[model samples]
Target: MRQNDAVAANAGPRVIVFIVFDGVTLLDVAGAGEVFAEANRFGADYRIKIASVDGRDVTTSIGIPLGVTDIAASIESADTVLVAGSDNLPTRAIDPALVEAVKAVAGRTRRLGSICTGSFILAQAGLLSGRRATTHWRNVRAFARAFPDITVEPDSIFVRDGDVFTSAGISSGIDLALALVEQDHGTDLVRDVARWLVVYLRRAGGQSQFSSLIEADPPPQSALRAVTEAIAANPGADHSVRSLAARASLSTRQLTRLFRSELGTTPAGYVEMVRIDIARSALDAGRTVTDTAHLAGFGSTETLRRAFVEHLGVSPKAYRDRFRTAIGT
Candidate 1:
């Protein structure tokens, strides 16, 4: 079937099935479900369901119980099938039955998606082979190693390759669901849903999952951590290699080597990433583009715009227009 063809075929509500498993991440299942539920509230016709290998109750990673239907019953005529992520991935063995079921379901569904480590499930089912996909940034190396045939885009928030979609981490599932909603309905409705949920209507799929402040791996108890913390705290400061090296009590060559060894980036690259993260947050908070540029230490709006486009694949104004909540609208 063509992507979204099932939704368009029947004049009735589209059936969205969440394929969950034992030790699933609760947010991966709930976050995407909430977006579709909110879309329904905005007048979109969609019906959601939670399904597992067998029709039974499954415990989430955090010990929450979720009731689910059997995959056999749920996949009968699904418009969209989303495979929810698991906390026990890469290390845990997936049921062969579940993999076979997913392979069968993919042929019948209009579109299929996986959230975070759920991409591993899809890949195991052979659904993601030869497709461009992504998962949690932390798992990218392992995923690539396991599935050499799949093209993994580690930095992307989400990726859409033909009828298959994949999202990074937990919250990114919400972004993918919102994108699906926009595809099935329209931007206005998805925008309203995003407003209600207080999230970006659409964080560009190309946006990096790693924020230098949060995701960068710095050596513990090392000067590199201090330098990174300083950069994050004062993004507006002069973060040239010389300035940062002095603050870290290291020579410029020492700082550069430490950054590359500990953080996998050059000192200048690390500074730019931190600045971009700050600028993105400021834009999401509804700050003016020009003001955000200066505040994030880009020196000028034009410079900031280039950084946004280079890093996020979208202009700053476009990102803000899509994500900034209208305070009283």
Candidate 2:
């Protein structure tokens, strides 16, 4: 807060501008801003400025009032410009005034990036076209559908595509800010910041570790729905394509066809996906690796290892370690 108050008064610090709006996510601004602020204590001077479209203070998502440093159109000497995200960004349309303000500031900033759903603002401004980016996992499908030109990395904590970088929301947003600070300083300086903040210098894995894949409703078709329910009820059961087809009262080929048509996967693939979901649950609940493999219906630990790697990109033991790791060293 002190750094933000004295930013314009300081002459030599690199200007960091954040374009905020009404209903802006507070952590999206604070998490990243704190990284730069902590870096300053180590002699990395980053002058933080919070700007709005019309130069008026706005309310945050949590209903806290945030002060404004300047209007977006007046942003200058910005070493980096970050747009904070909002909860309504995914469901509502981007404000045209905000888009124009971002575009105007981009011309002067050396680096342009966003935290959380702020990528939507960058996308709406036509700046992330043909760029690889990411956002909160819940919005990945909608974002990809809305912008066919942008390559959306659905599970990355953060992604750097040339000069425009985008990152996931909340804690992942903090990770992105740490990476930016690393680029300007070095690993040593970033490690100090991470230590001061009591977080990992670099956290493991991606957003997939935190997202739920089994929350969707079961298939609507009775036969397909029955098979899905059976799979979820007892992943340890013998759910071979033949067994499932028999339960669904369809020929093996027809069952395979239905699974492909309605579920986008073969019966065997569907079973594995469900089993993986079960395995993830078991791991998260502190089950032993061997126990998790059997409970999740993997015939052997090796088989379970293969499935986990193929789908989640992390071994079961490694995934489990995520839960065990503490915040501080």
Candidate 3:
């Protein structure tokens, strides 16, 4: 059977096809595939299949043969088709044959996605142009530079731009897979799947910040940059929604709409994240959490702790101790 587990009572299973090529990163396939397979035990239905550019078996990154059940050209349709990442992908020209296969199956899938650096294949096929996407943090710079038309979210663990989804390097595919399961089945089933997998249902933020609400990019327009730059310059400034709107010569609603459309964040959210960054810097410099709180515009130690835990999944003191500049107390 194509599925790792029986379909059980379902009328039809969600067909999830993983497209692979030689030297494909092994975890990029197994990490996500395991999530979907485990979801099945919790009453979800996912039919997982492995495919290669050709029907022939291909060698994986670990020098083991991964037998393919289908060729990319043969898939009639799929609930989701994810292109798996590889260490080799970002460094070399994507094989034209692989790109062709992705192009052929992409239109037939309900959602087309990529795991880690597999985004290169989709981008190579011109499927990700004008779409917000992510790849392994290590390759994000190259991915962005090579595919200038695509908006590369450098820090995101995963990005879903419309029906297309892209995830950060390696293990983040598990995060994206859980999200897909959540979308299909809901939080209840996905929670069980995550518990079994021994992974968080959601990580706080992306690669750089460990902050859940960081902005994807600096705004492209000078007007928006003016507002953002002001906040960064003085994290302690009174950056309420009304204040930022006035600074930008816009109304609060207009400011919000612009932030959402242009930067993928709210004005207030941006300000808070900037303050968090400032706080992190202060803590890294060996400032006490209380001192860091005011330095970062948080106003109180309790507030700073709450913000840190909520956004970065850690406390100020904990973050400081773990990443302090000095070696000793």
Best by TM-score: 2
Residue-level lDDT for 4 in candidate 3? 21
* Candidate 2 displacement at residue 207 in angstroms: 0.8
Determine the backbone clash count of candidate 3.
Answer: 1
Clashing pairs in 1: none
Single out the weakest 10-residue window by summed lDDT for candidate 3.
1-10
CA error at residue 166 for candidate 3, angstroms: 0.4
Q: Per-residue lDDT for 105-142 in model 1, tens only?
A: 77778889999999999999988889999998778877
lDDT for each candidate structure: 0.84, 0.85, 0.86
Error (Å) of candidate 3 at residue 46 is 0.9
Each prediction's number of clashing residue pairs = 0, 0, 1
**What are the TM-scores, per candidate, against the unseen true structure?**
0.68, 0.87, 0.66
Candidate 1's C-alpha lDDT? 0.84
**lDDT (10s digit) by residue, model 3, range 1-329:** 12222322234888999999899988999999999999999998899989988788889999998888999899987888999999999888889999999999887777889998999999999999999998987777678889999998887889998889999989999999999999888999999999999999997555655433443656476567789888888888899999988998998998899888777688888888888888988887899998999888999999999988777767788788867866556
Ranking by TM-score: 2, 1, 3
Assess the local accuracy of residue 102 in candidate 1 as a C-alpha lDDT between 0 and 100.
78
State the displacement of the C-alpha of residue 324, model 2, in Å, after optimal TM-score superposition. 6.6
